[model samples]
Target: MPSFTLPRAARITRITRTHKIAVAVLAAAGATSGLAVTSAPDTAQAASEHAPAAVKPVDAKGQPAKADDAKTGRAVTASVADHVKVDSVAKQHSAKQAASRSAERPAVKDYPLSIMKDKGIPGSYEGLHRNIMRESAGDPNAVNGWDVNAVNGTPSKGLLQVIQPTFDTYHVEGTPNKLTDPIANITAAANYAADRYGSIDNVDSAY
Candidate 1:
């Protein structure tokens, strides 16, 4: 048989008909999914606008659960910072108040002038001699074996009978560190008495 071919007009008409059929099929598919045929770029946005609301989380009582505030984290951080700042300020204020109280107390001044000048201490020789007589009778190497301090392993020694820790703490800057040195012991004891009772002369009892 000889090859048969459609005329040019007939071929064009067939192609146009096939194109229409394809477009119709695409339009039907797009309509079910809310796609825009005229503006393809806006298809997603248009579909979202018409989409159903999402299901919400529910509580045990079937009420919609409230979302946590985004600022909750910041609020907690700010609270901690504020608490720390307040605590710091309070501690500083307490320290200042204690210092002020310490500064307000007047130092005792019952020492004799002659002893103050002779011993190079600002306290009375009478007070010093009295304490020495009572504590160790002016013995530089006197050691208490029955006292509470001795029981605690920090027995008082020296003419002024100061413990090692006390002597070390109140030892004059230029004085020898020996606990039995007469001048060092007396000076350290006088200094401790001055700090505690305002002056060695103010202490008439065991101190």
Candidate 2:
């Protein structure tokens, strides 16, 4: 079909008294669904008056802007841009948090007891020393020959009698990886005691 636009000046049709009489006759004829051609000029004029505006062209910058489009409503671009900005900030914050945690982690050492202050062990030095003495009599190479751990073939050893598996599980960072090494053994034992019984100083017997 061809589309035609009539000028505003041409839309005001000169209706005659004969047209009104004809409309009354059509109504009396009981027309059901046919167009009332007598009212065509007014309908055309109203449609032209309410027509939408044309889309505007883009400018030089790449940023999204409201196009002068014929749409009466604004585009939903602003909310989408805000969501992108929020996601970028969240990702940056997460990366910074991860970096900070990594920086705070302590490094491994040859002697764990040497880094007592560095590891920030919870109890006093004297208290920890007392617990170590009760467990192993200050001997780093002490071995429990008849204990449950020894019977199971994973014997307890060192200044603090810790079984291999238990020591490995609770082994603190910045400690030597040896069961007989006094500092490593003491630190790992303290860590295990702290986990189970609150602290090594709190253990009154072989825990």
Candidate 3:
């Protein structure tokens, strides 16, 4: 029965081989870890360069502003258009009102002195002329402002100094209705004279 141990030198040689194999494995692992740590910053920098830039808001005209600015511009334009339309309508209405006011005023026309004879009234030119000159100095727009009729607020008016009542009652046709109209005043006074005093030629005084 032989039981013998390995020599001491052989044991030492085996232990040295084991220790070298472990050291080589640990060195290879350390190198791989260093390579991973060193390449991390370069990978991240490349990824950032290749990535798309951050998107910014833009208007409808492709300008670099808020997208809502386009809507605000459209609203402002619409408000201006509405204001212009209202102003134009108001101008047109004012013009139409002015034209209506102008249309309401009547045009005055000039009449000839011989209108009484032309219209078949019973009056002579000399008698009418004398009466006109004595009453109002041949002025068609003459008024009796200090007379009894004037104090009563119905002042005598026109060439023959006829009051409003006398003028309206004996007004001649085919002549201007205004009391200041020379031919109309003459014809009306002449007709009144003919009705009361029988003829305009017979009258000489205030009647």
Candidate 4:
């Protein structure tokens, strides 16, 4: 009655309603397919994130495991067993080295009489020294005033009362005549004494 053609407003409303239904149906179908495809992966991820980490294994009695197990990331086990083994090997090596060195060390010998002779003191000088000590308290100038004509008589000529004959027998080439000259007298006396006794120890004992 108002108009034989549909009104403009009516037509727009019908198109809008059709589009809304189509969109709703498509949205519902998309949601269902997405849930089906992603469900397993989502469940797995959630379990991994929220679940506790795996624990290290323990013995039946709950004691800690051995060191090798600990090194491989297990808990409740000692971590130094390998180090202890290495230390034991090192200690054994050191002990062996020390023993080898001790075996290689040289032995020391006792002092020898030949060595003393080389040092300027002969083996036989011991008795002469003792006699001099007794007669003069070891004084080279000590006199025996009681004896008459005691061979030049100005006390003993040297450490061994060297008189003329003694001096000729044992005097060193460069020595002097004075009895007080310790070097000359000691040299002569040592040589003569050595000739008389086998060794200095024997002379020292007699003195």
Per-candidate TM-score against the hidden true structure:
0.42, 0.43, 0.43, 0.32
Q: List, residue by residue over 1-207, the lDDT tens digit for candidate 1.
A: 999999999999999999999999998888856755454657678889989998665443345554642324454445557778999999999999999987785332222333345556567767888888988997889999789999999999988789999998988766687988877788889988988998888888889
Candidate 4: tens digits of C-alpha lDDT, residues 95-175: 999999877763211122233345555553345456556546766665555544363553345444545455558665555
Where is the poorest 10-residue window by lDDT in model 2?
Answer: 68-77
**Clashing residue pairs found in predicted model 4:** 123-200
Off by over 4 Å in 4: 1-121, 124-129, 147-155, 199-201, 204-207
Residue 191 of model 1 has an lDDT of 84
Question: For each candidate, what is the lDDT?
Answer: 0.77, 0.71, 0.77, 0.58
- Residue 205 error, candidate 2, Å: 1.2
Error of 2 at 22 (Å): 99
Candidate order, lDDT descending: 1, 3, 2, 4
Q: Give RMSD (Å) of candidate 1 vs. truth.
A: 14.5
lDDT winner between 1 and 2, please give it: 1
Off by over 4 Å in 1: 1-121
lDDT tens per residue, model 2, 67-106: 4422432343444566688899999999999999877764
State the lDDT of candidate 3 residue by residue for 40-67, as single tens digits: 7787788999999976645434456544
lDDT winner between candidates 2 and 3: 3
- Relative to the true structure, candidate 4 has a C-alpha RMSD (angstroms) of 17.4
TM-score result, candidate 1: 0.42
